[model samples]
Every structure is written in C-alpha cells, then in structure tokens.
Target: MKNFALFLVVCFLWSCNKDDQVETYTYTLGIPETMTKVEWRSQVAVQAPKPIASVGKIYAYQNYIFINEKHKGVHVIDNSDPTAPQVVSYINIPGNEDISIKNDFLYADNAIDLVVFDISNINLIHEVERLEDVFNYYSDYQMPAEVQAADYSNFDADSQVIVGWRVEERTEIVNYNESFFSDNSLATNTVGTGGSLARFQIVNDFLYTVGSFELKTFDISNLSQPNLVNTNTAGWNIETMFHADGFLYLGGSNGMFINSIANPAAPEYVSMFTHWDGCDPVVVDGDYAYLTLRGGNACGQELSTLEVIDISDKSNPTLVAQHALDSPYGLGFKGNDLFVCDGASGLKIYDKTNPLDLQLLHVFSDVQATDVIPLEDRLLMISDAALYQYNYDDQNNIVLLSTFNLN
Candidate 1:
C-alpha cells in the first residue's frame, strides 16, 4: 500500500510540528492564597467622549478611531462599522500627548513639541511639521543635594562662623538664584531645569527621542527633515522603546536599556535590566521583556508596579513576574495578552503566556486607561480621550464593541 502511505506522511508531519509550536502557556491564579477579597468590580459597558481633557491612546484604522488626547489633540473615530463607533473628527492639537502612525504619517507628541501629521486626508487631516526647539538646548540640573552648604543638622559651636557664611554660599544656583529660596522652597519654582520630554519611539527609519538625560536619534527617513542621527546618554528617563529582533528595548528612570541596532547609524549597548524605579513601560516579544513600573513612591508612597521579564537570556535577564498595580501607565502586547494602562488600575489584562505565571485576565474600571490597542477579532482598542471598544463576551463579559468621540 506504498508502505501505508509513508506512515501516514510521517504522522501528518508530526502533527503539524506540534501545532505550530509557540505554546508556552503558564498562567496561574486559582485564587486562594487565603483569598484576599476581590469579589469583582469592573464594569463600564460603554463610554465615548472626546472633546478632549486627558485621553491617551486608541488607534483602530481602516475605518478610523485614532484618538490620543492627553491634554488635547487627535481624535477621529468612525470605524466604518466595528459595531458602530462614530465621532468623526476632532483633531485639535494644542499640547498633544502621544500618538503614532507610521506609513501615512502622524507622529504627535506635545508637552514640549514634536509633530507631523497628514493622515493623507483620511478626512482632511492636516499639519505636517512642528518639531520645536528639540529641547532648545536642555540645561538645568541642580541636585547635588541641591547645592547644599548648611544642613549639617543644626551644627553649632559657632559652626565655623556659620560654616564660613555657608561655605561662602552659592556653589551655584543659577536662574538668578531664585530669590534665595524659602518661599516654600524646593528650590522655589526653580525654573529651566532637571528634564522632561522623556520618551518617544519608532525605530527603523528612526525617531527614538527621549530626554531628562538625553538620547535622541532622528532621521525619519526625512519626515520633512528629521535628521539628527545619534547621540546617546540616556542614563535613564527613556520612558519606552521596544523595536525587536535587532533589540532596542529601553524603559526608563534608569533601568532597562538594551540597544544593539545592528548598525542603524551606530548603536550597540546590549545589556542592562535593573528594575523598579520610575515611569517604565516596555513590551517585546521573541525573547520576552514586558515591563511596567509606573513611577516611584510605592502606592501611597506613590507609583505602583507590574513586571514580567525574561529576556530570553539577553545577557542574562530574569525576573519573570511581579505585580502590584496602581499607576502602571501603558504597556500593550497582543497575543498572549498583556495590556496595562492602570492609571488607577483601569484597563488591565494579563495572561502573558506564563512569563513566570502572570495571569490577571480582565479589568475595565473607571475610564482613565491611557493606552491599549489590539484589533482583530476579540477586539480591544482603548485610549483615554475617547475611543474604546472592548468586546470580549461569550460570557467572559466586557462588551461594548464601539464608542468613538474624538474631540
């Protein structure tokens, strides 16, 4: 019989390579570590508002749903028909927050500039260049104990003529010495200093910006003259940076940095995975790295966390689990699920295919989500300024296939 059809074609090619092998499910939470109450409370069946106030992410494309308002800017929802989501347009842009689009252009960012829109007129989209002062020459740091000189904890014995008039006061205070503090001093308004604008990403044609400790690299292939090319020093505050395969996974407040751009205008650090510090947000696949640490304090001490790391041995990184959510700001991943915007633990969902057993599953709560995008079937597409579409029912409940109001 032709040797039994070659043993059934080698058992159907070994059962189709064990069903396309990528199976690594490890989610646990059979509740009952003495079960610390959580009877369940997450419901927001629907909501759609976008005249803007403080939204953060949502992009569904192919019928629209672009929102990004976190201080206003971008909102265009129509979604053709993902079950009716309509708000048409509200592309304002006044102090935008975050946005991305790639192909047809749309790379917003406010609180200190970087814009580029032209949705190819998805319905009259506009603007196409903004890029302000690119940090207008950042220079304001202080913190060497804020130029100390006194506080030897009430020293006395004539404290050497009051420590020689506070060590001849002024190791340096700039900004015209801020009227000598004490108007409720924390350096009393200390203008022009420290750092901000600490995050941006879009590797591959480059855009990588970040501040509060430098790390730029523009050259958007010429998004109307981007060109900056390379300059590193991001010792931290690099908010986010994922890329993949060729690695570039940063996350900030000085922790995870992994660069190895394979030579995209020279980049090659490849190592570093500290954790728990501040404002971190990262997501990666094909070797794992899904971080989140929402700033620091603790929870009441401020900042909350949720980590899941296992960089597939990327220079030995490991700590496959840690969750204590509260302010876990934005971190999206689709496919083994892991979405967290937690500005109060609102849009959290985690399964993470066992990166050491991470499994939360669902949460929708009070609408302060921030960002989360995943649109193919079970649909999920969130953002705060207006554009939400959860839908995950069959009993797991979480309905609301659409709601688009991008004001």
Candidate 2:
C-alpha cells in the first residue's frame, strides 16, 4: 500500500508539471506580389522635393550633388555651401540605380533602358533620349512577408520591367528556409567622379557598365544620344568598375581583372588576380590597387579584408599587403589618406603612405558608413540613413561639415 501511494504521488506531480508548461507557436502572413512597372518614359514628371528614404550612389558636379533614391529617382541637392546643403528638386525615374554627369547631360539606368536627361536646370529636368532594352537580365524584386515565394513568371522583358514591389497580407504558414535576396557619360565638359561602389564609368567618349558577367559599352560621343557599341564578356559576379589612365579595373566576386582600354570601345583583357569569393570594390592609386572584400549574403564567404596589390606591371599584378577588416564595404583615397566604410563599425581612415603598413588614423563610430567619396575640398560618406560631409586638416583632424538624413 505504501508503494502504490508513492507511485500515485509521482504520477500526479508529473501531470502538474505538464500542465504548467506553455505551448508556443509561430504565425506567419502571406504576402502576394503586386508591383509592376508602368511606362515610366511617358510618366516622367518633376515632383517637389520629398523626404529621402532609400539612398544609393551619389555624384557631385560643380556646386550641385545628385543622390540616387534607389529605384525611385534622383534627389538634387545644392551644396554651394558645405555647411548647409539644400534639396533643390527631385527627378522621378522609375527603376533608376546609378547616375553620372558629363557636361550638362545626366545618364541613368531605368530598368532595361539607358535614359539621358538634360540637367542644365535642376527644376526643368527632362529625358532627352532613352536607349531601350540595354540591361535585360537583372535580379527581380522580393516581397517582405514571410509566407509566399516570389514568382517572376509574369515578369516579361518584352512588355514589362521589374521596377518596384508592393505588399499584401494574408494569414498562412510559410516555409522558413526559402528567401530571395536580389549609367552615364560626359566630355569636354568634365565627367564627374563617382564613388568606388559605382559600376558605371565614362572613359573619354565611351560609356562602360559592368553587369554580373558582361561589360556593355556605349558610344556617347553624342551627348544626347548614346549608341550601343559592343558587349564583351567580363567575368563572373562583376561588382564594380574603376577606370584609370588607359585601363579598366573590374572587381568581381572571384577576382580583380585589369583590361587595357587602349581601344576605349573594345576593352581587351590583360590580366586577372584571383581571390576568395566575396563582394569586392576596388580603387587604384599610382601603381597600387586597393580592394576591400566583405563576405555575406550572395558573396559566398564570411571573410572581410583589405588587400593592397602591386599593379606596377598590369599583366603580372601581385598582392603586396593585406589587412583583415570588420565587414568593409566601399573605399576611396585622397592624397595619402584612405577612407574605408567598415559597415557597422563606421568610417575608418588609414594613412596609406606605406601600403605595407597601413596605419589607422581615426574611426567615426556614429554612423554605419557604406561608401565614401574623397573630393577636392571635402569628404562625402554614405551610410544607411544619412549622407555626411567632413573637412580634413593637415593634422588628420576631421570636422563634420553637414549631414543630410534620409529617414
């Protein structure tokens, strides 16, 4: 009888413990695809300056600065006074990704088309010409909700372009694992320099743009109308392009390729310096090429590093020095100072007078910087939420000139 009573007590305690435990469940919402591209060529209209949100590449020309608003448009900001910049106007171009200025013309990519705009008067910006169906293969838009997978079957290149995305909610259980993550020329009127993250660059009269696996060239000898000259096979996962002297440096996920642009219209491959798979952006100074490789997402690795390569001989480039970094993104140089955008670690400035031993000068930890442009008189740093301008002195001291927030 005593053994039976003890067994009953143990059973009762187990039942009580089971009842005390709470059950947890995850609920997900289904998001259906709703965004479609309209005929933006006919819908081009100048809107008043709106709030800045998704910022991409930035280009400065004369006293005006053009900031890309992701796929929406370009925001024109007058920075005549570095201390206080003003948003003069906004040019609405659907599916716009990058911008470059030469003389009075602004070149931008709109979905599959290369659109040229007359930016002589920021308020009166108008599309001068559209070269249709240039970039046909690009990543598609992804929905935010967790339930349904993106369906691109309806996306027809002949009639439509994936310009943007829209979200609609429905209650459903989504599989947790499946997730999809996805311009310009100028002349005699000098072409404005772009950030290291830029993929579109203008060399003399030819406009070069690097896609994932090809380099498309356009003869922009005529500013208003750009002609498609040729498309050459670049390499796998080409992320950015930098032009110097008579050569083109193509930064790919797998390697750095140097091409001789002796024939600006047809770039010939000279050499390739291979590296581990990662997203890389490169900038060249003198005989050295500096590349920052950060691994994450589609980059196929988890290593972050800054590599200094000796390109004294373009055909036989050699890696001279390397330094590990904390998720470095875009980098640029001014004089002997190199600025690296170290993702969440902010902006890291290094004195690269000695490329073998790059000395850390300063780290601005306030913002999550992604790219930088070291111009003649000031420094422009781009973060996820803001654009920062700073002035550097001989003592290596950097003073904040102004900040334009895109919240």
Candidate 3:
C-alpha cells in the first residue's frame, strides 16, 4: 500500500511538469526583413490598379480618392459614382506610405525620399521629382510587439533597408503573461486606415508629416519640386497628423501635440495634451479636437477611450470630455455628428451637440471598421476587409453606399 501511494504521487508530479504544467502558449513571431538599396530604389511609375497590399492613408480631391499600400504604392480610385466606384490606376512607388494632394500634384514618401507625382492628367499620371534621403525618421518596417521577434543585432543598415517582415508561428505552454488573438491582432492597420490616421497633411503651401518622433516639413510651393525644409523633434511615439485652422495637431502613443506652422517651413512647438499611452489619431472640428485611444495587443495600451479637448487656445488645449470606448481607432466629424470606428464593436455615430454627454445615435456593427473620413453627408470608411462608403443623409438611417475589396 505504501509503494502504491508513492507511485501515484510520482505520476501526478510527472504529469504536472510534462503535460498539465508550466504556463506558455503559441504566438506568431516576426523577424525583420531587409532589401538591397538597388532593389528598394527600383524604377517607379504609374500602372493599372491591382490588388493593393493594404490600406494606409487617404486623401480626397474633387471626385478622386488615393489609397496607400505601405512600401508598395498608391491607388487612385475614381469615386465619380460612389455607388459604383472604379479603380483608375496604381502609382508604382516603392517603399511608399503617406500621401497628400495639392494643386493637381500628389506628395508621397518613398522610404528615405519624397516623391512627387503630376496627377493633373489622371490617365497619364507621372513622377516628376524624387528627393532623396530626406526622411531620416522613415520607419517603414516597424513590426508589432505582439509578434515575438528574432534577433538580428548585427544586421547591416548601410546597404540594406528594412522593407518588411517575415512572420512565422510556434507553440509553447500557455503563459499568463503571453498573449495571442484573432489574426494575432485586433487590426494592425498595415498603414492604419483613413484620413484621420494620415501621416501626411497639406496645409497652405507647406506639407507636414509626423514620423515616430519628429516633424518633417516640405515646401511644396514649387509643386513639382518639394524640398525638405524642417525636421523638428515632435514628441515621443508620434503617429498621426492633422491640420486644423492654422495649427498642426500630432497624435502619438502618449498624447496630442500642437505646433504652430505659422512659419510653414519651420513649425514651432506649442503645447501637448498628455494622456495614457495608446495608438491614436487626432481630428479637429471648429473649437474642439477629437481623438480615440485604441489599446490592443499591438498598441500596448491599457484601455480604449475617446477624449475631446477644447483647442480654442492652441497653446493650452484643455480636456473637457473623456468617454470610454470599445477598441476605438479613427474618428471624423460630419457637421454635428461624430463617427467613431470601434474595431469589432463597429462604426458608431454620435451626436456631439452635447459634448459633455454624447448621444449615441447609431451603430453599424456588421463591419470591423478601422477609420473614417466623413466627406459631406457621405462617409468613407476603411476596415479590415474593405473600403466602405456610406450615405448618412438620414443620420438615423445610415445606408451602405458601396464597397471596394481591400483583402
């Protein structure tokens, strides 16, 4: 009987250690990839539209819209008929991401350089200039924290450019501190969707863009030749940018930064509205500035929230309202309505007439929305699966206008 009891105890200990034990789990891991300078700077041109890698920034001009496929190129979509939009063409710009339109010319970043395109004739769009090595803050190959990375400590940076990543998978026992989810992310945005998540914004004759931690300004007065004028240390983890009234608003992982572009070429740092760390994008309407804090497996933030700040005074932005959110991403305004794209929770329309107590008007929960650009009564939304257009003429009865497949 004593021998039998000892045998049972040994079996339990072995089972706990070998089968039922040590906390761990499986997660998709990513490794940084590098490309030869020669390959990265391959000849770029305009081609017919093909399936884009992913949606990045968005820009609207007249009846056209530009969508970004990070490190790949930009697509020109003809939304002349929103109900039946057409893919016009594709700008084959290697290592491209953000874009902004001004006076028929489109400004885009191509890795460490700024490329300008003459789109006056959409049918024959052509590249006019390639300003090299200007974007010192260019971070095109940033991978997610959720994906455990392999070491590449001795990687060469002189002749190799980090173009993308190599993703793979492996399993381990479930660890309480480890994490994994659908797609290994709520959504990475690839380039982060919508105009609200736009890295570039054109205000006046100056083009402003925010990198990971700096503000880069370009003088686009020459249209065809945009020269890099100023590169100012913006803030830590700066992600998105917006131009409202006469100021440039930069949204980062930790807070909102306001800069005076009074001297377009040289933006002067004004103030910052601090908040909990998260991936965010700031959008402004009239006297108030709106942003959403999206915490996710990739973002590393603790909570999802919506914050509204009074920006009447650019130097001292005051937070007057704070609301809880369900994994919010991008936000935009349509007159009195505020559209919040809350990941899987859906696209929520709020009546901001009462900012202190925002009234939830409606929710389009069928789609996994990422960001939005409210154009007139029509809303342009980018999600994980597609680029969606909606008609919100009837605020209470918002209807899907059309969709362009992204995946």
Candidate 3: stretches off by over 4 Å: 1-33, 144-158, 164-198
| Local accuracy by lDDT, each model | 0.57, 0.75, 0.75
Clashing pairs in 3: 23-174, 24-173, 24-174, 24-175, 25-173, 189-192
Work out the TM-score per prediction: 0.28, 0.80, 0.80
Q: For residue 298, what is the lDDT in candidate 2?
A: 51
Which lDDT value does model 1 have at 180? Answer: 29
- Report how far off residue 46 is in candidate 3 (Å): 2.1
Q: How accurate is candidate 2 locally (lDDT)?
A: 0.75
Candidate 3: worst 10 consecutive residues by lDDT? 2-11
Superpose all Cα atoms of candidate 1 onto the true structure and report the RMSD in Å to 1 decimal: 27.9
Highest lDDT scorer: 3
**For candidate 3, lDDT tens digit of each residue in 150-213?**
3244335556666666777755454334353222222232333112223888887888877777
lDDT of candidate model 3 versus the reference: 0.75
Over the stretch 173-288, how does candidate 2's per-residue lDDT look in tens digits? 22224321110110111111112222789987988988767888999999999999989888776888998889899998889999998988889999999999888899999899
